[model samples]
Target: MPELDSSSMTNPGSKRSNNEDCFLSLPAQDLWMVADGMGGHDAGEVASAIVRDTLAKYPDLPLSESIQRAHQAILDAAANGIGAEGMGSTIVALKHHGENFEIAWVGDSRAYQFTPELGLQALTTDHSYVQMLLESGAINSIDAESHPDKNIITQCLGSQEMETVRVDSLTRPWQPEQWLLLCSDGLTDELSHAEISAILQRYRTPDQATRELVKAALNAGGRDNITVQVIAAPSQPKPSMRAALAHWVPIFTHSRRLDAIIYTLALLVLFALLYWTIF
Candidate 1:
C-alpha cells in the first residue's frame, strides 16, 4: 500500500492588495485546480473567481465534464466583461483515476510531477510569447524567463473572439510517494527548478512546502500573485475486490458525446450484473 497525502498554500505577495490566485482540491476524485489572474485592473480578479466558483459547482463530475464546465464558464465570464474592456485567467487542473492522472491547462499556469528519484518534470507548456521565441530559437529556454514579453500570454480565457482551452491527458504507472505540483506562474517566474526542488526536499508535507516556497518568492520580490495546489496519492494500493470485479472506465479523453456513450454503456452493464446476481 502507498501512503497518500497532499497540502497546499497561496500568497498575495508584497505588491498587490488583491491576490488573484484561486485553488481547489477534491480528494474524492483526486482532483485539484489552480488559477492565476492577471492584474492591470480588477477584471483579472473577477475572471479568476468565476472560473474557480464554476468548477466547484461540479465537485463530483467526471474529469472531462468538469473541465468542459470550467471552459464554458470562462467563456460566459468573458461575455460579461466590464464596458468595452476584457478579462481572463489561466488555469491548470488535474484528475486522478486508479493508476493515472489526467491534466488540463490554459495559459502559463503549470503542472509538474516530482519523485524522489526523477527530480521535477514539467508537464504543461506555457502559452506565452516567450514560448514562441523558444520555439523559433530566437532565444534559449534560459532567457525566456527574463524576456520582456514573458508575461504576455498567447492564449488565455476570455481573450479571443472564440476562445478554446486545451485539455491534455497523461497516464503513468502510479507509485507511492509521487507528488504532483500545480501552481501559477508566480512561483515559476521567480524561482528555478533547482530552487523549487530544494524547497520540496526540505519540507515533508504539501502545506509546509507550499508556504515556504511562496515565502521565498515574496522575499525575492513578488511581482505578481501566487497560487499552488498539491495532489498526492499512494502509487499502488490493492484494489478492493468488489471494485476489481466491476470493470470501471474513465472518460477524460473522450469527446462530450462519446463520454455519454461510454458511461451509459458501463452503467447498463453494471445494473444488468446487479439484477442477475442479486436475484
Candidate 2:
C-alpha cells in the first residue's frame, strides 16, 4: 500500500476573529477534508464541525455517502440545535480508495491535483452562481473572479432539505510525485491558480507546503477563515520501519484471532470424525 504524507492547518485569518472552517487529515485512513462554513451568531462553525465530526466516523467511505450523511447531520441538529436552522457549510474531500483518488465536493470548497507533468489541474468545481455562469460561457475566468455574486453557492450542507443532494465527484489514478491541495474559498479567494501553483512548485514536502501556502494566502489577504490540507505521495513511498509496524499492528492482531478460531474448528471436526470411525 502507498503511504501518504500530509499536513493541515486552519486559521481565523486576518479578518475573522473566529474561524468557522474545519479540516481533517488522516493519512492512515487515506482521508482528507476541508469545510467552509456560513451562518449568523457564529453558528457557522457548528455546522462545519458537525460535517467534519460526522465524516470522521467513516473515513473509508466514499465522498458521496459521507457528504450525504453530513447533510443529514446538519438537518438533524437543526431540530433543536441553536443557530443550526440556517447554518450551512461547503465541503471538499479526497479519499484514497485502492489505486484511485476520489474527489468530492459541494458548494465552493475545492480540491486541486498537481504534478510536474500536468502542472496543476482543479479536480473539483465550485457549486456557485459564478461557477455556473463561467461554465455556461456567460463569463470568463477574469470576470468570474470579481463577479458580484461570486460567493453565492447553489448547494451546501444545511438545515433546509434539498430536493436532491448532488455531490460532484471524480476518480483519477494515483500517480507518483503527485500532490493534492484541499482548501476552502479562503485560499482561492486571495491566491490565484498561478500563485498557488508557484507555491506548490517551491515546496518539496507536504508539511512545508502546508505552512507556506497558508502564509502566502494570509499575506495576500486572508478575508475569510482559511483551512488547508496538503497531501503528497512520493514516486516510491516507503514508510519508516516504525510507521510500517504501527500500521500493521492491528492487522497482525486480527490475524492471530482468526488463526485461533480456524484451529479450533479444525480440531472439533477431526475429533468428531475420529469418534464416528471408532464407534
| Highest lDDT against the true fold, candidate | 2
Among these predicted structures, which one has the highest TM-score? Answer: 2
**Alpha carbon lDDT of each predicted model:** 0.75, 0.85
How far residue 98's Cα lies from its native spot in candidate 2, in Å, is 2.7
Question: Candidate 2: what lDDT?
Answer: 0.85
What is the clash tally of candidate 2? 0
Candidate 1 residue 224 C-alpha distance from true site, Å: 1.0
**lDDT digits (tens) for residues 132-245 of candidate 2:** 999999999999989989999988998396834689899889888899999999999989999899889888898998899899989998998889898885457479986664
Candidate 1 has an lDDT of 0.75
Off by over 4 Å in 1: 1-4, 60-65, 78-84, 235-279
Worst 10 residues of 1 by lDDT: 245-254
Give per-residue CA lDDT, model 1, range 1-279, as digits (tens): 233477767788788888788887767646678988664557777777777776778767765566666656766765665412466778888877667777878788999888777778898888888898899999998898678888898877656564455655556666577778999988888889998888877777887877888998888788778887766756465799755644454554547556656777888999999999999
All candidates: TM-score: 0.77, 0.82
Backbone clash pairs for candidate 2 read none
